[model samples]
Target: MQDTPSFYYQGVAALARSIQVSDKNSKFVLYMNRADYLDDFKFKKTGVNIEILQSEYYISDVEEPESFPGSLYTLDVIKKIAQAESLDEYIILDPDCLVIGEIDSRFLERHGCNIGFYKLIEGADYQFNKFPFERYGKDINLIGGEVIMINTQGAKEICQAIGSITDRRGLLTEEHYLTVIANQGKIRYCHINTEVKRIWTRMSYRNCADRDYLYKIIHLPAEKKKGIPRLFDKIDFINSHDDLIESIRYFTWLKESVLLDSISKIYRWTKNFRGRA
Candidate 1:
């Protein structure tokens, strides 16, 4: 099988570990504003063909103009750099995500969809109050920027559009900006299962399962009250091998083959009870 093309931020050792365990052949491209901080890492040894690109988007964590000249600008630059890279498709994962296990590359293939993202919780809102409707001018639900997989054409389009926007006050965050443009064009978009949506607030895995679909990805924050990672933090909820594989297979496109049945059935049975009341 061919390797999946992926990207991550600097200092995301945990995410890198997950990626390595998922598939030894996957290639990862990391972005950093300062190359010196990540010079010590060896991507090839870790099962990832690492490419450290210069980041135009970075800050001392949260030091900035509150919103402007921070992640927005940084992500814009990253998008541009990503566009310049050559790859069949690329998944941009935040530094805080945990891969649990390898994902079937077919799911990430561009099915005529320019972008792949998951919907937010039904009632709660974080980035845009109006959500996809407000940002995209349509009534579709909103998606997060945490785990984004884009085709090369989509990458270049998003990069150029984001680069053209010079003001921040009037616009939402970078994620919203990218989705908004895609929406305007009615870009062929794909919706991941609700299981992949962020489970930060009162949302739980059981709650997600109630929707009858699984999420191959979930977005959690970095900061938190009383040690709980925020929706943007690099922490994860999956803690075992089965959890990893099952999570990756949620709403999966890969056929359930011999490899899947080979995993412990005990874990599969137990998964039903997990995240449940």
Candidate 2:
């Protein structure tokens, strides 16, 4: 399962294509803000079992300084989908991720815990230690949210905990809450030495395959680069194996041009107007 905003349609296509080539038996579900933004014509012939679910926008009355509105609600959406569909377990992936190789389901099965997630590599501090370390002690490991395997029951507990939070001072974002849970030994943390790896920071594309074990899934977080050309190059490199990346590159280039952006916006507006009429 993956959650994607409409602006990252190309990433969705790349993810779908990667699954089609690598893990054909696995089900691929996409959760998006707007369902209509998906162009069915592009994926109808691909034989990929893709399901698109429209997630409800979460509106919070409380003024949050650190977290964005509807940001923390993603977990709620995942929990609702799992319960409504009677799913035993589901892997939640960010839209910008690609499955380059086969993901072994047996590796993700949990015995005692309800949740599984990737822990940051040992001895590699990425400066995510803003939480109160005194509460969790110094031996706690920080987990990444880019890819999470959740059990419906445990997720419900996490959601309840999130709802009970009145003070948002120490906890900055959803990742922090998840880390806290992992620190308490509430969740199972997957190691980086396995087939799953995360690229937290921006790095050269050539270094992606330099790891000891071949990574099955690659999580690319959204990072803002200085120049348009450099950013496009990085996007192209990370998604080098997928042809769908070209579309993303083209759309990005279009967004960089003022005239193209204006024209594209007008076209979308007119199309929406015609549909209403």
Candidate 3:
């Protein structure tokens, strides 16, 4: 490890702002490919160590030719942070994720073995979900890409293993990279059980929950609250916080950015056209 111990998140200035609050001590680095955008983030006043990753690092070798710029950029940053920190272990958290409570370090202590992750799509659903999940000529264990904890060794192995598959024509995703390495016996993945209330955080889009409104402004209809359990009210209470709102925005941008971006593009593309149907 050559650099200071740090946490890494790539993308907008908004994400860095959210991360600054949740992970106050760890260094934060933002990897922006666009220089103009890079200048915009200069005054975000992100308290942690903030540096923009160079774009050249995102290029894939011949083997992984189809690398998506975004995924490759993230991978490049992860490798850079892991190597720079020489950290025994480090976390890669989605900026949109709000830390309601402290993480379970003990959960990560079970390191050499698989660490916690959400389940991937089942084989039966592969035909429908494969376009999103299957990558790099291998089946991906559908896990949340937002938060990952890795020891120095695990990080090193993941970095090296991913580098070998230069042809990303199939596996152009960060989560699938983990899946590919794990299936190859190069690494083990711990499956995080969603039933356990606090072992992990949930992705709203995956669960079909509405994901707008600033975290500080969840306006539950008073009528709807009547039949709801006290627990439900509690859930709403926590969700209505400024800090949490910022964090969720940060995490959601990177995790759902592609989906959101695609939707925006489609909407824009169709705006000028008339539909006969």
Best by lDDT: 2
lDDT (0 to 1) per candidate: 0.48, 0.53, 0.44
Best-to-worst ranking by lDDT: 2, 1, 3
In candidate 2, clashing pairs total: 0
Report the CA-based lDDT of candidate 1 relative to the real structure: 0.48
Q: List candidate 2 stretches off by more than 4 Å.
A: 1-7, 39-62, 68-70, 85-88, 110-112, 122-125, 128-139, 160-166, 185-193, 200-209, 222-277
Candidate 2 per-residue lDDT, tens place, 158-203, comes to: 6665555554555654566778766665445455336567543322
Q: Could you tell me the lDDT of residue 34 within candidate 3?
A: 48
Tens digit per residue, CA lDDT, model 3, 100-144: 333454455654442444454453223323333433344444544
Question: RMSD of model 1, in Å?
Answer: 10.9
Q: All candidates' TM-scores?
A: 0.59, 0.61, 0.53
| Candidate 1 lDDT tens digits, 52-146 | 54545444334533443344543654466455656566677765455544555656463556566665655434433334354335565455666
RMSD of 3: 11.4
- Per-candidate Cα RMSD to the true structure, in Å, reads 10.9, 12.6, 11.4
Score candidate 3 by lDDT: 0.44
